[model samples]
Target: MNEVVHTSPTIGSNVEEIVFVIVVVDSTDRERISVTREELYKMLSHEDLKKAGLLVFANKQDVKECMSVAEISQYLKLTSLKDHQWHIQACCALTGEGLCQGLEWMMSRLKSR
Candidate 1:
């Protein structure tokens, strides 16, 4: 899926904070696959996400045909994942359900650490 990156979003009262580029990818089924994180980790696990300042948001959780969060995580062998503390959640973006909380959690997770 194509994504448009949002830069310097005023997430809450936080002013001019650095926001990571958000890469959008499909929550897959039909076959097993690796997340971009895994791809990067295979290429360089020691170079953790902090080294690259990367964060992932695996979205599209409410599609009728979309895979469950566990399925996506397992198919990607997310246990092999590292660096970034990201995972999928059941969401209906069209309805604004769970998006804000997810975004807030992301902002806090990346910022507080």
Candidate 2:
């Protein structure tokens, strides 16, 4: 619903279930947004949500037009996430690279719980 690229309707029957929320961000204007890193942390740090957890797919990684992980992390101040299992991964959906790893990490996190 929120400018998402491909949204599969998962609100239904017998799916394995999604335990984590995957929050996407604009690799460019990280500063202009209010509901960015802070909101993500709020979601992840919610008392009830602590176990459910979450991940972030920093897509558009292959583009010369996109921000690097170091840059994005600096802007978001994600050093705290390193110790936590906040899976922030570099991905290029255009080339289908790193997509499986991102999804695999999500599945692993869910299964591990």
The candidate that wins on TM-score is 2
Tens-digit lDDT track for model 1 on 13-51?
Answer: 845544343444466534424545456455434533353
- Our model 1 lands, by Cα RMSD against the true structure, at 12.4
Using all chains and alpha carbons, the TM-scores for the candidates as numbered come to: 0.51, 0.62
Worst 10 residues of 2 by lDDT: 26-35
Off by over 4 Å in 2: 1-18, 33-35, 81-84, 111-113
lDDT string for model 2 (41-102, tens) is: 78767765665645667777766777776776666666766435666778777797777888
Clashes of each: 0, 0
Reference-based lDDT, residue 65, model 2: 70
Off by over 4 Å in 1: 1-21, 28-58
Each candidate's lDDT (Cα)? 0.55, 0.69
